[model samples]
Target chain A: MSTNQIFIVDDDDAIRDALGWLFRSRGHVARLWSSAEALIAGGEIGRCGCLLLDIRMDGMSGLELFEWLRENGHDIPVIFLTGHGDVPMAVAALKKGAFDFVEKPFNDNELVDRALAALDIHHQRSSRQAAAREVDERLAQLTSRELEVMERVLAGQMNKVIAMDLGVTMRTVEVHRARIFDKMGVRSAVELAQLLTARTPKPD
Target chain B: MSTNQIFIVDDDDAIRDALGWLFRSRGHVARLWSSAEALIAGGEIGRCGCLLLDIRMDGMSGLELFEWLRENGHDIPVIFLTGHGDVPMAVAALKKGAFDFVEKPFNDNELVDRALAALDIHHQRSSRQAAAREVDERLAQLTSRELEVMERVLAGQMNKVIAMDLGVTMRTVEVHRARIFDKMGVRSAVELAQLLTARTPKPD
Candidate 1:
């Protein structure tokens, strides 16, 4: 059982206090922030597990804060708490990668469920990102020429064809192929193709 | 301007013809199969993209076919085309990882949109899975003792602390840390932590 902290960001003192109490009663550590600015100013961001953000806040709106965090490379998952009129905005946030949106006066269980789901997703995203970074690091080990060979292999070019295309001898291609396999640690072309197909482009 | 192929699998010739025409007119290459077995036997599975699978069939039920493919490690994205009374089965398919479920007599545009979304997701999933395999391969290069050290370092333990815990000399810990960084092609502990945290465990 993972113990996760929840950060509640809402202007309404009553709502924040109530949620904090509720989360604490459920064995979660809940921290209440009166506004997005307060949460940002506090600079205690990474400690909380996930965020419960109100759609409409005074200075920095929830959506704006979300955008800010995303641009700055913070991938903490957020679940939006929205008023009835804010459904469209919340939906837009979902498209922009908000985990889930709960309408105002949400069922307590439903909100908790959404929060838990958001945490699960955040965990998954974090895991995938870590894995991606590892791949990037390994790919960095290849020499420029070896990387060229890899690109050809990933593009489904046969070794003889790659040798001809790169104007290298077949033996050279074979040597590079062995090195590529050793460096990438892939046993076969199919596995290598699978890896290439799934690689996300590194940020520029 | 992403180009994707759509595969329509159904026993009904009319539905297949209709969907094929619809997809083709929208600039997609649509390939029709008369049955799940036919589609599998055709061996054109990897060529023309996302699947439009009909739920009810004579030999293999769409759900069963989906489960079989998934079990065999195929990640081809599928959108279930169901009849009116098959809504429950469709829902169950969605839970089982079908990209989307649509009933017959569905809006043409809606189907197209869902198919497009499923294709995009399939591409992303395939890419991510490939990248993850690369990470797994690189991690596999570490010796058992090195792996234990790497795990502790990634968990944010200092080298001295790790040495004490592992009952190794501090100099030995330093040697292991250097080898880990060199093998993993990582420059810093923070980056290594990020890499380790981002990996998803294979499903149990």
Candidate 2:
């Protein structure tokens, strides 16, 4: 479960209240904002899983707020509430990576489904991000010499060969390898290699 | 460069001709079709990098055509040509993974720019798909026993330890390791591991 809120930002009071009730009826926790500025100052921007924003707000439209979020490195999934004319604006926002948009006369069930999908994407993205951070933290604990030994170990090098290549004694190479495994919190070279490989770039 | 043709599917002859000139003016080879049915029958799909499709046509609308392409496993990036009334339909198509939509009365330069971006995405996607297929082919060539040896070798096991664990002679283990490396087309265990790792699921 994401444990993140779904945000609904619209200038219209009726739309906001309706959307809030709509999300709540479907067992989702939603935070409603009367305007984009109100949402920005609400101090809950980056913590949300999904957003349903009115595309054509009075000041600082939904598209502008989405740009702001991207500029500040927030990648929250956003579904827009669009008027007939606002479809073009929605298209532009989608190109900039807004998740999806719903035209004004939206079906309650359909809107709920889209929001749930957005939340699922957020869940996946956040989990990968969390995993990457954990890997980074464990990697940061290793000394340069230990990292070098770990690389050789990952390459299936025998300790004797690694020692010879590094111009170090076999005993010193073994000590470095042990510390590398300890810092990486892996029981074997295979486990350490798997973790590190997942952090590397994909094949070109 | 993708070296793939850009497809333009629209019902109106004038629109198709205008778009053809616009694309050629931007140094792209575009194949134009009078309708969705015409484009489908043309059979140049599954190879194109991008498409400009009018949202509404006399028969087999653009959305329907997009659905057909998806069901048939073609993932071409499509930019929709949408009239005012077709905006909602365009939004629905986008939700179904249509790349981007340009409302009717579009700027030729902007449309050309979006099409070029779609081509770039296609290049990256096709490259990755090619890499994955190559990996699968190599893995398929290995026998089950060689695969088992390959796993331990990737784990950085010494030949002596692997032979003992697998109840095999040291010479036999060395042969299997060499065969695994040779079959995978890599000189070292690290290169082999990196190639295989990219095919696995991302970190959870």
Task: Name the candidate that leads on lDDT.
Answer: 2
Candidate 2 lDDT over residue span B1-204, tens digit each: 444789999988888999999988877889888888887887778657888899888999888899899898787788888776455665677767887888888888888988888887878777777787899999999999998888788777888989998999999998998888898897777678778877784432
Each candidate's lDDT (Cα)?
0.75, 0.83
DockQ of each: 0.03, 0.37
lDDT of 1 by residue, B52-169 (tens): 9998898997887888778977778888887743323433465466766677877999889889887887777767677777778878888999998987776557788999999999
Please state the error at residue A138 of candidate 2 in Å.
Answer: 2.1
Screening candidate 2 with a backbone cut-off below 3 angstroms (N, C-alpha, C), the clashing residue pairs are none
Writing each residue's lDDT as its tens digit, candidate 2 over A5-76 gives 899999989989999999888788998899889988987786798899898899999889988888987887
What's model 1's interface RMSD, roughly to a tenth of an angstrom? 13.7
Residue B87, candidate 1: alpha-carbon lDDT: 26
Question: Per-prediction TM-score, chain A only?
Answer: 0.79, 0.79
